[model samples]
Target: MRLLGFGLTGLVVLLALISLVLGPAAIGPAESLYALFTDTGTPLTLVMREIRLPRMVLALGIGASLGLSGAAMQGYLRNPLADPGLIGVSASAALGAVLAIQTGIAAHFAFGLPLCALAGAVVGVSLVMLLAGPRGSSLTLILAGIAISSLAAAFTSLVLNLSPNPFAANEIVFWMMGSLSDRSMSHVWLALPLMVVGWALLGSLGRSLDALTLGEDAAEAMGIGLRRVRWQVVLGTAAAVGAATAVAGAIGFVGLVVPHILRPLVGARPGALLWASALGGAAMLLASDVAVRVVLPSGDLKLGVVTALVGAPLFLHLIYRTRREMA
Candidate 1:
């Protein structure tokens, strides 16, 4: 337990240091650290404050939210493989933001996009839960999620196709690809408070999740309120995930992979796993974002694509190993 805690802490600290120091510029760690408090190099200071800080803040915010949300979802459903996007919640949120952008509503109302996305996520997940019934049908939930995701994707496409404005299609495509580049402080502010609220709500679900490991009937026998627990995770997830998708678009893989990777280190307890995943996720996405800056010099690489590159293999490996273990 001590070693696991140390390791997670070390990884998080090291990753944060790397994110704050390393960048596309030639500013070394010494200079960057120096300029952190003292404004030495005007250009480097500007880069750190105006550009990198906002991006880093966003990286931490969105990554942590996704990780915690995934852990919560897995706990709520007691499914190791369950994910928010996999459950159709993320797709619905994305569609909502896209629609807002298409109608030019977001231009006038800064918070409109995220608000719409939040509403869309609520609707999508509501439909999924309704379809799965009160029992939360595991297989049916997955199927319902898939069906809903497909429908949302189709509708988003149809909207783009029907729009007279040509920019809408391209913008929507790029938005879905997910980039953290050139995002303003406004985006950071928009997501941070909401994500904090989500974290608090979801973080409290740890004990409930631990109880849920015994199955709903057993848990209820132990005085656990399963319905309340379910809402805590679901609504909490939607808010955080919606806020994240609103700002950074749809960056995948963090939520799915972070908790699983850290579960052993954090112990098998879902609660411990949840907080650790948030920290680990902040590390992962920040590192990935930094890596994107280093790898491609021509243009800004989409954060989602980078995560997908790493996460797709992990997903495949999980499936293969699961098969082996079962076999």
Candidate 2:
């Protein structure tokens, strides 16, 4: 497990380096690395420090947030399909951002949009917890999450529908599609703190999650607090995923896919999967961002679109495997 964790960390670092070098303007790997560290006010330095670095940071941060949250949720819920998106946190956060955009508050206040999204995430997760209860069954949690997702999506559509500004509507639509292009360090600054907090909250649950694998009663008998675990998972996921969606606009499946891919490497230990999934998710998103640049240098391809293209098939395979297992 330690070896696997180290391997993933190295992979993520490699992908981050690759992300720094690959972009519209051609920069050699060595030069890019140089500019990243020593800024000499050159165009390459400006691009490296101002643009690519932030995008790389966000890609890693958002991916880690989603991945860690996914692992924590899956462990807490003991369900393979449990994810931030499954509980409507992403959708709700998107709606908050959309509202900010439509109201023009985001334009005036730099942090307005992200703050609103963070609030929406908190509400969404809280509602999910309320509906599903602290100790709800897997089916109950899924149903509650679906209900929350549907409601949030509808509200988001309604906001778009009522907007009189066509450009604003189009912008909202495009943003919802998700991307990592032309992002500034401000975004990285805005989302990183919340994501870090979320990571800490979730990471603290390693032992609890491991105990959970033995069943709730067994975990309880072993002195684990189920209620505390639920709160931590819910709030932590909201903070991390909400901040991510605020900056990146609903990049899905990093959470859903990363843990599943790396779980085997961690010997299927939920607690041990957290850091591995975080590193794997960062690597995956960085690679996807690189693919977007190469595949569509014209910037036509969205990050979310690329992830969905990859994740949807993996999702189907997971479902098939699950069915076979049940059979």
Candidate 3:
């Protein structure tokens, strides 16, 4: 299964490479490789270097970030449905990005918006934890996440409403919807470090997550300290989701859907599934982003819209499956 996963992941990377090179003014693999490294002055080289590379990197980073974060959440909560978006983490990050754009913070510094989004994620996790409380059940955590998301969303709408500038308001509207067009390498560089750190933290949780399969009490008996695991999950998820949102806005569904799709292929083991999910997620997201470009040749397409179009139905399917299992 692991070998199959690695092979699948490699196939996805190949597809991403094809996507990167097969655009309207497409370049061959050799040319693309040369352009990617040599950084020549030809138009094809420039396009491959400047336009496609950044977008590909953004897709990979955002996908991996969402995928691992979701894996961590599912592992920690002992529920397949527990994802970063459901827990208000992504919403908080989006709210923060929106606030930054509307208030001229992003105008001051290019990286300001993503940084603020990261901050928002931190606050969101803090609030959700507070509301969930120590003895909270899985249901309690989900409810708290919903409550926190609603509150954060309201605050975001309120902030936008109170803004004096109409342009900023319109900008805020687009920012919330989420897209990857016109994103520079600066955005990629801005969020990648934190995402890397977050991935490391999440990946390490695999063994802990496997222990969690036996239930929290059993995990504790096996010396997996529950409190420590909880903090690690929260902090690790916040880092990944927040950083990705800071760069890509609120990209929904990738986190939730990736884990569900790959879990079975990895034999449903947390210890082995974490990195597999990350690679699968990167491939999945890059594929989706490539699809967006192919479908909308006229202009840029919304990243969230593409993911949601694919993700919404997948999420519904998961819910149905969960219900069936419970029944």
Quick one: best lDDT, which candidate?
A: 2
Across residues 154-226, which tens digit of lDDT does each residue of candidate 3 receive? 9998988898999998888878777777778777888888888888888889888999999988998999877
Ranking by lDDT: 2, 3, 1
Cα miss at 5, model 3 (Å)?
Answer: 2.3
Error of 1 at 235 (Å): 1.2
- lDDT, candidate 2, 184-291, per-residue tens: 999898899989999999999999999999998999999998778877887898888989998889898889988898787888999998888888888888988989
Please name the candidate that would achieve the greatest TM-score relative to the true structure: 2
**Given candidate 2, what's the lDDT at residue 64?**
91
lDDT scores of the candidates, listed in order:
0.81, 0.87, 0.82
Q: By descending TM-score, how would the candidates be arranged? A: 2, 3, 1
Write the residue-wise lDDT of candidate 1 on 1-327 in tens digits. 667667766876776677778676777897886777688768888777767778878888888899899888887778777776877878998899889989997678968877788788888989877886665645676788889889988899888889888887777888888888877778888778888888988999988889888888888899988777766776788778878887888898889888877776766788788888888788888888888887895686889999999988987887787799899
Which stretches of model 3 miss by more than 4 angstroms? 22-26, 130-144, 317-327
List TM-scores for all candidates, in order: 0.88, 0.93, 0.90
TM-score of 3: 0.90
Better of 1 and 2 by lDDT: 2
- Tell me how many clashing residue pairs each candidate has: 0, 0, 0
Candidate 1 clashing pairs, residues 3+ apart or interchain: none
